[model samples]
Target: MKNNINIPKEKLNQAVSRGIEKGRQEKPMKIRNSSMIIKRVASVVVIGGISLGLTFPVVVQAFPNIESAIIDFVESVLPKSYSNKLKHESKKNNIVISDGKAIVTLENSTLDNYQFIANMIIESDFFKQYEESDLEHNLYANLEVSIGDNKNIVGWGAHIRKIDDNKASLVVTADVGDIKLEDNVDVYIKLQGLEIQSNEWKSNDIKELKGNWDFSFKTDKVESIKRINIKDEIELDGKTMTLESIEVTPLASYIKLTADENISDKWVFASYKIVDNNGKAYRNAQIDGHTDEKAWNFTIAIYDDLSNIESLKITPYTDEQSIPSKIHGQDIIKMTTTMDEGSEVEDIIVSRPVEKRDLNVDAKPAHKYEGEKISYNLNIDKEKKFYTIDELIGKSINTGDGTSVTIKDITVNDKNTTIMLKVNGDYNVLSQVVLFDEDMRDIYSGIYVTHKGKWPSNSHWNNAKDTHYASGLATFIIDKIDVNKKYKLAVPIQKEINLNSGHTMNINLK
Candidate 1:
């Protein structure tokens, strides 16, 4: 599969070797597992497109003045791997503006329906005194968008490359939904508050610097786009999930998915990939938003050439709903007692859980707890793999909200505890599952599988499974559970509507 792509020969050889080694080490997987593995490798190949030598089509179209030196600027701002993927061409609109403390020169900008990307240069006394690392911690570009009379602050990220003691080049970007140029709209950006103070990277850290350098621009041109509708549905377990449409813009691709209304079982459509006629696949980069009731919108960064994209494949995920039963201890017997400095085992009585029951909300057991507390005593000489759980228990939980989740089972050992969850509500419950001790500090669980660009990290537990179509198990880990201390499993409450307001200013540039 690597040989089929246009990447360099040496990289292809490396990829093939890695794929083969990975395939050999994996436990027995489904028949289609090989195909999925190949697709994953293909996506990685798309990211390393520096040597592919494909011309930057959209970037070239917009930014004609992009020089070879810009490559160095890009490398300074982004990760070394992403320096090569920066857009070089864009719709050239060299608009410049300033706010006394700094001067900004907007060299070019482009709009891809969903997002706005701009190329600009900044000259300021505030930036001249800082090093690249200092600038990274201190500098930021604040952006605001106004469509007709509807104005609001937008979320944005920027990359800055220092050009000299007082100047730097930048690429600022923001995702603005459902943009229509026909509406009188304007974008305003400012570079201010340049100061450096660092500890750990906190999301809500406060800033103290006060330098006001601003730039504002508007575009009258709108690319004519036609969205393609592919209303397709996949059904399983008496539920239906639908793929509503695919919007392929010049910059990226968008997919719309909707779960059938009023369905009880949580449907996860995890697999969203675009396959070209040549079999090259593109993975999703970020989510746009939830467009309607039980509907989601997502975007894919089409970094690779998209001349031959044929269709989008939406695969259904498999569900794991039952827990495994216990096994006998004597059937797995091996011995070698580890003697502590002054301790010795006179007689060993191996014990296991004699009873199990499913639990409901409020910690009520569905059945009476019979016999001893569920446990297993291990033998020292036996390999850890040989020691297995002798009892399994499940529980059902209501998330205070209307949603409810089922704790299909739990297994604990000296090393870690694994909790398997099955959401029985209309929404995906995996992202909402939080495990905390009585003190309420968030515990860090080992990341088994995390989908890139997921809003909350580890939102999708099974990358191999089609998450949107089926409910897959979520496994959480903790070193050990204390029988005396209280533990709670919860999904923090989220506001359905934002009621807070922010400051806004209307500045006119002559």
Candidate 2:
């Protein structure tokens, strides 16, 4: 084959050189004939064999079996760890275990029912082992298992297998809504890597289990029984009564009660009493009640005497008969009573005075009247009437001259009415003369007395020596007066007098 191939190559090269020489002989008439000859020779060698090998090199074409080729390619491209993992997964897919009855259904005709059944068995076992290894100590004890999206089981279905002496593997399958367990129990579930969404949790007996619970996701509602376990013994009037449902919240210290009517209207006609464990009447126990529409709500603070009140008795009075009902052994009680027609309840709280005591007992001094020297005399032994200094001052009257006239030795009903006058050292003239009663009203005129005294000059009065004249007759009518009561008497004295040369005088009455 090599000799034949080399022979074709040599003959092709000779044919090319002959064609070039023929071209050169035919084109000898031109001056470029020699250059054309040389060019033809180089082209023949290059295109004929040596350059053909350098440009279009040889390539061997051989193929192995198709299956083995694919396998080898896959193995060569993938990492050793990944390749081993795929092999392990393929082996795991073949081995199947079912924790419960495996239900297989084909909704779409494209899916193979047998293949789905196998897949579910594998998934169930995987979840079972996962839950057993993960959540053994959780409070939720029961377990259920299911496979695929089917309605074969309406409720929870679970299966268990013995794993060890003390522990067991469990598989659970249930819907994502409305799941509940019995009291004091918990349920743990694993659905491969699927998430669950639920709303409510409820139990029949909250007292036994204690209404305390924890949840992982937000739910719509949870119901549980709240128990009031009495710490101390209480006396009940009856065996049992329908208790009003009260909303009890977690971690709250006090119990709250709501009513449908005004508390005053409901409790007013109902006589209620609360006694503590010691059986003492509570004092100042506050009872507050409010009204909402036709209903009454009341809150009563419990005290120590009212403290630990294990019993409460209520009595209602009616026209037909008196009905007495008792609610016993409850810290918080709520009830309603009807009000009588045309009758109303009144506030029963009363006001009382707080006690106080007196402490001091000392006397104060009397007040002195402000005036110049004035005189007064009283003769109660002779008159059987009262006379005070104010009455004497009322009898005095001012004269136009520098002197004033006053009654002397005035008597009323045999009582001596004495009088005295106060003359300032600067007073030099008098204005008018009139006698006034104790009320300061003019009762008599002292004109006659002033005219009788006559205007006397300081020189002519040298021998007078500030003398006072008195008359034994009654000078002014007087009315009965009380000594304890204060009275004012007005007497007009000197007016507008120039008394640069001051002089003093005195007048007396007896």
Candidate 3:
């Protein structure tokens, strides 16, 4: 009506429909733009809130709880070995994580029942990993115990920590007994750390451990001991006795002996042939005592018949001696002798001297007598003593006459090389006679003369003229000469002899 124009109904309707469709599209665009702007603002707020939570101290503190809960859960679920490994790493790195804790204690109702006691504590962390790649951590405690009683019996107590797959910490304590011992004893331990997986968190952190121990006993039948060595002041009496070399057959039966050196001089020893129950003498063995410092040792051979020997008797050499000389055991016996007081031994002796004889010597010249015809006779006597001619002859001489004299002998005093000679009639009277070897060089001259024989009186002759010479009556004792060599004696006599009308000069050597 307003258009007043008959615009067709289809055209009007079409325009209206197109306009609605366009409005619908435009509305959706406006809604989309508004939604995007609202979404971006919400995202910024969410990011700011997360950042604030991280920076706040209260929020950080809250996180530790969560971490501790997670570590505890993991420790409860992990294996003990695995938990221990994580504990060690955390300690080395100075790291504190949420891990479970363990505590151990040792208790005694009566403190007097224990003799010695000790306490020990340890702290460690625990951790574990699961089959699904999950991890957990924990802590634990252990206790060790050692106890001794009046009966000389010992007891031990130990608590072990174990982590299971459920992340649970299992504590187990074991009490063991029947430890009967008379002396000291020791225990060895091996420890390691590791991680394992379970249902809850568990800590391998081993904390408070009680290692305190106690020992107590009454000093009842304990045998007192003293060491002794005996080496000197003892002797063995037998056909053949070895002092230190002898030994007892079964060594375990012999008890170590004891003595004091200050008192050892009073100790003595004696041995006897042991007799068996069968009346047969045991091996003729003997025992010797030896003392090294304050101890005594006895050496005895194995008795051939030890089984039959019944008893051995021992008595000190003196009642005042404090040392016990007799050691008695089954089938074995030892005896000690007594030292005599103020006993002394004498010194040794020496021998006397013998006398030697002196040698005798004599010398004389030739003589001439007047009668129908005269001859010289020289007599010599040795004064009943051992004498040599070289001791009387002195030396060699050379005269102006063309003659040389040498004294020599093929053998002298049983020696072949020594020679002795004398010349009376001389071409040249040799003032000095040189004794020589085969080479003719001088060997001995001064105080060495050549002659052969023995005289009764060298200083006093009974049957000789005023001028008488004996050339052959001298003897020589030679020393150190060769046996296979030959020698010669050369004598140069005067070419002429002067005789009176009825007198002739003669020279004789005897």
Best by TM-score: 1
lDDT of each: 0.37, 0.21, 0.23
**Runs with alpha carbons beyond 4 Å of true place in candidate 3:** 1-260, 263-266, 273-288, 314-510
Q: Rank the candidate models, highest lDDT first.
A: 1, 3, 2
lDDT of 3 at 205: 35
Candidate 3 local distance difference test against the native: 0.23
lDDT of 1 by residue, 1-510 (tens): 001112243443344335334432011111111111121111111010011111223322233223333553343223221332234433455555556766555655555555555666665666555543231133444433332223444335454444345555666655554445553247766555444333223334435446555656664334524476666665545656566666555555555555544433333324233344444433344434323344433333333333444443444333321111222312211111222223333422233232211121233242443343322122222221111122213444443224345555544554445555554433232332334444433232322111122111221122111122111234354444443344444332211112111211111111
lDDT of 3 at 85: 28
Per-model clash counts, in order, read: 16, 24, 104
lDDT for position 122 in model 3: 21
TM-score of 3: 0.13
TM-scores across all candidates?
Answer: 0.43, 0.13, 0.13
- lDDT for 442 in candidate 2 is 27
- List model 2 lDDT by residue over 322-401, tens digit each: 11221121111111111122333231111111111000011111112112111111111121222353444334333223
Candidate with better lDDT, 2 vs 3? 3
- Cα misplacement distance, residue 355 of candidate 3 (Å): 26
